[model samples]
Target: MNLKGVRTGIAAACAVVSLGAASSAAAQGQCSRDTLDDIAAKYVEGQKQGSIFTLPVGEWVDYRENGQLVSTATGVISQPSDFDWHLALVDTGTCHVLVHGVILKPVPYVVTTQLAWTFNGLGQIRSTVVREGDANFDAKKTYAYASKEDWSEIPAGKRDTRQALLALANAYLDRAGGGAADVALAPSCDRIDNGAYSTNCEPAPGAAFVDREFTVDEAKGAVAVVSNRGEAEGPQDSRIFRIEDGKIRHVHAVTPSQ
Candidate 1:
């Protein structure tokens, strides 16, 4: 299932709310990049230890100064889609929040099973938005909780990071081949062939061309797929994919410019 689109819509809503709100107090000092780095390091360690993998409830202090609301973080994670991670962050000082992440499942339904943070206290998350495979989303209806039994039933192969990467690539290829518009391909698929663009092929006036290459590093469990095509004119460039999934499902892509 593709959830990136839905996650993106929610992230955008969080941004609007964060920007509209006023900060409760000014930040005494800016958070150092090193501080963020340390926090990330610990976060990774916690994940590895399986100690901090569960989501938090109510309010929590992600960053603190004497525990006085220096900053707060709230977020949600989704599963079974293109977005491996979707996150939004709000700087309480300026009430500014930014959203970023990767999409893993991109077709039939986009799924963004990642994390997003909001700090301005204006950002709120409704995890029960809808069930994992529900085609329609009704705001008035409450979401049914996903039981542990349901989660355990998901096949391990479906949760494999490498498989997820390939699935995402194939989905993008399908979209490109289908003449779908506005769909972004991975940057790894972007390459030029003798002044000819590749990947993201669309039906041309006289000819239909689609061609590309992919490289998957098993050691690193990283996959890079590039698509390119040549027509009567020259060539067209496309996208790339950068995936990180080990045990639990996590996949993302970096655009050509990124």
Candidate 2:
């Protein structure tokens, strides 16, 4: 099946998902860093049990799946199943979490999915975006980055400041696009492009990023940046950088479909 065609069809079903009208007063600044982690866990557990309605949600929840809008009562929630998330990067500052792994459901075929869940200060979920694709779309397979022992934490001597991490990640793009002559990369630097393994850090001409936006999680030692670079060319490209020992160890990229 043509995954691009499939994605297009889904995108046509765009609709906004809202729980209801906002309460007379909304909860503000109630979520802490640890609270975000709890919310993430609840999201995963709720999905696994096919009971997302039980979770705490804001008065208005905007959801998009595969570039298409989805409601709480439909899509993945409708066909609830088990999910094995390999890598999860949580940005506590922004209250956003990005997770990638395979969804184990018998009916619709097993596939890998990248999901970003955003939260509000009221301790409620505000937005969710999911991109689903089959194994063909997942190059590095699942858990390539998460399986590494030191992926979740950056040691004291290895941690880079937020500014430095952003620069290093951007430098990688510059070097990849030939704007820079040198870029720092770990000896075993590996890149997972759209769920597949790729030798992107090698000496070769690669696509340049455009309209880039970045978010850094210092505590997590991770950075999430998205831009337009692939053939489709929009804001659909995303890369998560795992910086370790002052070098980029792994990069998980989700590029747009052509």
Candidate 3:
């Protein structure tokens, strides 16, 4: 479940080494929000088939599971199952989409997975990073959060600019890691790890050091952060924030690093 970084495993490590030298200009095609949504939907369907071959993808699509690169051929797509996509954040500007969902397979156990899908302008999948949790997870708690209506798109007037959204996410990370953060957390800010209820949005520092990664989706007031702990590496975590009256009203996370 905690497989570490893409630079860890043998096979995945090799891909990382070579892909670093791969030119980005070749895949820098522009993409639209609708296109990203369609791609995400296709991914959900592919998960059920246990093979993502149906989707438009490059010859060598970079794939990572739990930060570590797995067998591109038979790793995640090998398991066919029913997928329930709970929350989706589309960052058209970045040509990326982050989806929080659960993979339910009758054979073994249900798993909670957060998928970060990146696409080239040509609408083909360029990279996919999945953070999968344990097999056994709480369904009730997950449904409660996933069923909430607050996750919908924030109204334009209430929406924070991309910069502000990024700052809030950064501040929350700082506060969680014992750093002096000027952040505002909702009164009922709730956090979830895997599929279990974790905390009620408290300003408590966590054990590991958190490095603010990229803002995966500032439009929906959501951002993704990674922990930089020694060689083991930290989890690829994402959080969704609900803003009201210019203050953070609620917070939700999937595999929150803290």
Candidate 4:
């Protein structure tokens, strides 16, 4: 699809995301990180094996890719891919995990997916990937920066609560989307997309962010930031963040070229 076509799709994909989590997930009770981590492993295995059934999913798992709601059976997860490597952001509070992987086969693709393990079962998955034609997409470069970055658990003393993490992330989107959002950045913070890297870390010149979704991992002080909609310019969608001691540290994003 062309760029405009991609933008149109994101506009439609915005309605159903529910900002990336189930409304009653907390009431339903959170799953242990270990359990969520296991489900994440199965998700990667599903990609490696190309079988959606590999997930212990609920009766109906809502799967949305690139802002379009599609069948899980025909989704990327069902497509067999040989990956160079994969990294996962596990969030226990909301029972969500965002998996970022670089696939080697079927024409290189950088896939960033967020799957929610709900009380009903493994439910809700949203994905945005940068393939060969995507703007600034260089799988090798993407892997180089993304893989080298550290997303390991934050020390207990330095960890921020889930609520704080969410606020910080939205603040980023505020600045990213062209609004005046007071966000902090560590001296080390860098925004990375596919294979491109930049220390400037600015979003589209005037493009706004909407249809946002977040997968916050308190343990690691990172959140998977998804601006489900696309922008006319600059990068938008699936910008993951790593925060430490009230500062933005690292960011990895998936979007069409700016």
Higher-ranked by TM-score: 1 or 2: 2
The lowest-lDDT stretch of 10 consecutive residues in candidate 2 is 1-10
TM-score of 3: 0.70
TM-score of each: 0.22, 0.67, 0.70, 0.81
When 3 and 4 are scored with lDDT, the better candidate is 4
Candidate 1 or 3, higher TM-score? 3
Candidate 1 structure lDDT? 0.29
Best by lDDT: 4
Q: Residue 37: error of model 1 in Å?
A: 1.7
The C-alpha RMSD in Å for every predicted model, in order, reads 17.0, 7.3, 6.7, 7.4
TM-score of model number 4: 0.81
Per-residue alpha-carbon lDDT of candidate 2 for residues 1-258, written as tens digits (9 for 90 to 100)? 012211111121121121221121123443345655654566667667776554445433444453345665676654676565445556655555555444534432222223233332122222212335433454235344445535566666667887888888888776665675566778888776655666555535567766655657676677876555633434345677878767787776655453
* Per-residue lDDT over 98-130 for candidate 4, one digit per residue giving the tens place of the 0 to 100 score: 888898677688988888676655556778877
For each candidate in the order shown, give its overall lDDT on alpha carbons.
Answer: 0.29, 0.52, 0.52, 0.72
| Model with the higher lDDT, candidate 1 or 3 | 3
